[model samples]
Target: MSLKFHRDKLSPLNIWPGFVDALTALVMVLVFVVLVFVIAQYILGTELNGRNKAVDELNQEMNRLSALLMRAKQDINQLDAEKTQLSEQVVTFEETIESLQSQNMTLSTKIESLTSDKANAAKAKMSLEEKMAYLQSQIQELMSQLKLKAIAIDQHKSNNQVLEEEVASLTKKLKSALNSEAIKLANYKSEFFGRLKEALADQTDIIVVGDRFMFQSEVLFDSASAELEDNGKEQLKILAQTLKKISKSIPADLNWILRVDGHTDKRPIHTKQFNSNWELSAARAISVVNFLAQQGIPTKRLAAAGFGEFQPLDTTDQDGDYNRNRRIELRIDQR
Candidate 1:
């Protein structure tokens, strides 16, 4: 017989075994729940660690951006300062130019006034010249009258000797005076000639334009080229040195104006550099003027002019006839 198992049939040892089995299943279910909870916790912890690393990287990027922004701001400030300085310089330059313009205008007005005065003075000079001419005529007339009177007095034979003596004395005085005047003129010519020769002694194309040192059409320049050769420069150097010295000794009344005038042959130069004789002549003049400038002469005092075969000494084209046309005339004038 078996003990009652609460309205169910059972073996003698079945109740205990079933109770143990049910307890074991319940323990297994609890263990599975714990394992699930551990897995979820581990996943959550890993995600939290990854989020923290991302936040740290974002912080570093923000810091880097901040540094670049600061540098850019400093650069902008420097540029703005430079711009302001440049603007100030421009304003100062404009003010200076305006001041110069006003001063120039004042000088122009003074020049106009002086020009009128100079014109009026020129008329007065003409009047003085006329008076001097009249005086010279009167003096000549008085001399003629004196000669006639002397002739009449000498006609008497007794007084002839005395008259002759007086005439001889007058003649000697006139001769002496003429000799003195002639000597003065010769001295002037010699002085000018010496200086011009000294100036042009070293130059090839330059001719000392006086009574001495002969330079004709034959030896002055290249037939076609206005370009002065090495010899030409040498000659120019001597001339420049002489002029520099001569300028120091010129009369105070003279304000010497140095002009380099070029002349060319009648033939045209159709090269790339020059179109006509005028251009070639002009280039030669400029070349001479530039040489003078290089010799320490002021640019303001030097001027260039070209006379293209127009003012020839000889009318006909013959051998050596072009000498007059191919010339570099260094002219000195009181300006």
Candidate 2:
């Protein structure tokens, strides 16, 4: 048993060696595997760290690039704004240029018009200068003529003084003769008038005024008529007879004249025969002068005249005033 036990221990010892070898091999293999796992973990960690660093760098790069892009956009926006302002400035410059061009054109036209007007004014000035020279020469000629005329006027003044003296002497003699004749004629006129008053004593229409005899128109003619009535003819005949008697005593060179003046009232008259009171008054005076001529009075010694309403003895607006204004007047005067 002991032997068997010893043998058994020896056999187990052999097996233990084998088991020890196997354990040793397994330990070596496990150690190798652990080493390989540790190496792989280190490598993986390194790789992961490298990858994280790269990612961080890439993120920083992306952030930088985004900032650059934002700046670029801002620059683009600023450039666009500047471009817009430049465009507006360009438009304003263009409008200002157009306005300056229009002003320049207007100034050019005004310059041309002023140039033309200046030329015309120069021509007119030249013409005026020539006319002034001509007028100066004419003034000199007129001055010479005035000197000659002054000399002739002096000579005429001398002659006129002599003639005035002679005329004064003759006028004084003539005035004395005329006064003598006038006195004689006045005496004859008084006698004639006295005789006429006696001959026409029954007639009330005749009146003697200052150096005149007045007869109402009603006593001579009908209303608005120029013809002589029968009573007017008779009265005129008596006047003619008185005048003939007075003429025989008057001097032949007395130069006496009988003036028959016809007057009219303010009333207007319109007829086929007489257009106005002036014409009617003129016709009545002519009729009176013609009747006196037929009564043997010389035509040269008789005168006729017509006075319209312009000459009024009475200016009152009354019937009696109008009647007094309408009359015939007889006056004796020098021819």
Candidate 3:
């Protein structure tokens, strides 16, 4: 009985814990296999979805291509119709031209024969005396026409001369009257009246300076400020309008030059806008030029220069001579 008891203890019932552990291990292995299968299914499904999207895009592109092909076919049909119309018109025009050419050749032959008969008749009938009389009559007619044309030409020239004289007289009288007012202002001593040629001298501003109509710098602009005053702007407006008309009369092919020179007082100007009298003078000159440009003066014919304190009409740096350095000079030339 004792041996049987020991055998029972050694049997399967005593090793039940070992059997349970082995069963649990086998169940865990099965669960791991199921997890791997689930992950593989998800990956395969994602790949299929991506392939489906690519196919849809390809189909859309094909639809667009098919539409473009249809439009191309329509354009080709239109071109074919136009080509056929042009070909038919060309054929019809060629046939008409050929028919006209045949008729023209026949008429030309008949005209040549008739012209020859008429020329022979004329030659046979024309004696030297008759020819001389015909020539004399022709010459007389030509002389009469030429005399009339000459008379007309003389009349036109006379009219033109009178008109030019009248224009000159009017302009001179206007300028002379303004000069009288300027002469009153000339009492400033530093201020120059009349034209600016005297102040500008041989500079580019005075292309041709006449001594009789000359005035110094102060007649044209403000001292050290190239800006034209109201009085100065008005003077320039009249001059510019007059000169524009004069320039047009000279001929369309001619070009002229007009320059403005800005002279400044001796006082220096140091600021953000102007560094010295040079800049001030230049700005003033530019102002006058711009003012003239607004009055229909062509910018292509305009130029501005700054003389600074160098172009003093009074030749002195005295405060009283401040007016002498301010000038806007106008010049003209044919180039």
Candidate 4:
């Protein structure tokens, strides 16, 4: 009974040792598994971090590519707009070119018409010039004929001018000769007047006037009588002597004479010997001329004239005026 109990106990102890070894082996296996798991987790975490970094880099690259695409799209759109503008400008230029071509054709046709007109005008000008040349030739021939006729007229005028000059010269010479005689007569007359003025200086009633000597009617006659007074005869004797002296100095060619002009007042006179004032005036002048002739003065050198109040020294109807008008005027003059 004791041996069996001991054997059972030993068998139980042997079971406990095997069980402990199995537990330890199980613990070591669990530790090795935990270590492997930790290593695996570390490696996995490192690999996951590297992959996440790569993914973030790839995301940034994609964002950059998208921005580039947007810019390219904008450039294409702007290019399209510029192309549209260029097309419009091309259309305008083509239209302008066509208009210019039409104007050029019109100018070409006008230039051709002008050229034809210019040729026709040149032909007409040539014909007109020929007609003008013919007219000029005719005018020249007429001018030559006129010049010949003018020369002939000039020759005739020259001959007539010679005869006219000769006649003019002869007339001039004759006039000069006559003028010389006249000058001599005038000088002698002046000298005769000077002598008479000195001789009759005391006689206030006798006055010299413009180549003539005036004698009052009262000095020569009484009242309306033609008979000369004694004093008048003395005056006539002095005039006769003066005339003779002057005549001796005068040239024979000078036909000088002493004229006695008698004047009467406007009073009417009718008498036995005188019918009117004219007759009385004429008788007075004749009496003076006859008395001078009797005093040895040449009859041809004496003249008598009467004026019945026609030529008056004074025109007023007064006593003094009548006295002045009723006078005898003695003039020495050319016949």
Which lDDT tens digits does candidate 1 get at residues 1-335? Answer: 24556536543454888899999999999999999999987987787577556545655654554555455455546545654554565566456556555655555565567886666555554554565566456556645655554444334332434444554555565556446545654554456558776655665644554443333323435666666677667666776776677555543322346777777767667887788888877887887788789997767668888888787757777756666556777655434
lDDT of 3 by residue, 1-335 (tens): 99999998887647888999999999999999999999987987787577556545655654554555455455546545654554565555456555545555554565567886665544433443354455456556645655564565455456545545554555565456446534533322112223343433444422333311222445555443444567666656666666565555332223445666766667777877788888877787688778878999789878888877776767776766665445455444333
- In TM-score terms, which candidate is top? 4
lDDT digits (tens) for residues 1-335 of candidate 4: 99999898887334888899999999999999999999987987787577556545655654554455455455545545554554555455455445545554554555567886766555554554555565456556545655554555455456545545554555565566568767888899999999998888999899899899999989999988999999999988898888888887675556898999999989888889998888888899999999999999889998999987788888888998998899999988888
User: What local lDDT does model 2 show for residue 173?
Assistant: 56
Number of backbone collisions per candidate: 5, 0, 1, 0
Better lDDT candidate (1, 3)? 1
What is the per-residue lDDT of model 2 for residues 91-151, given as tens digits with 9 covering 90 to 100? 6655655665565566556656788666665555555456556645655664565556455
Q: After superposition, how far is residue 150 of candidate 3 from its true place, in Å?
A: 63
Q: What local lDDT does model 3 show for residue 38?
A: 100
Error of 3 at 227 (Å): 3.8
Each prediction's TM-score versus the true structure: 0.39, 0.51, 0.34, 0.54
Cα error, residue 55 of model 1, in Å, equals 96
The global C-alpha lDDT for each of the candidates, from Candidate 1 onward, is 0.62, 0.78, 0.58, 0.77
Q: Model 3 scores what on Cα lDDT?
A: 0.58
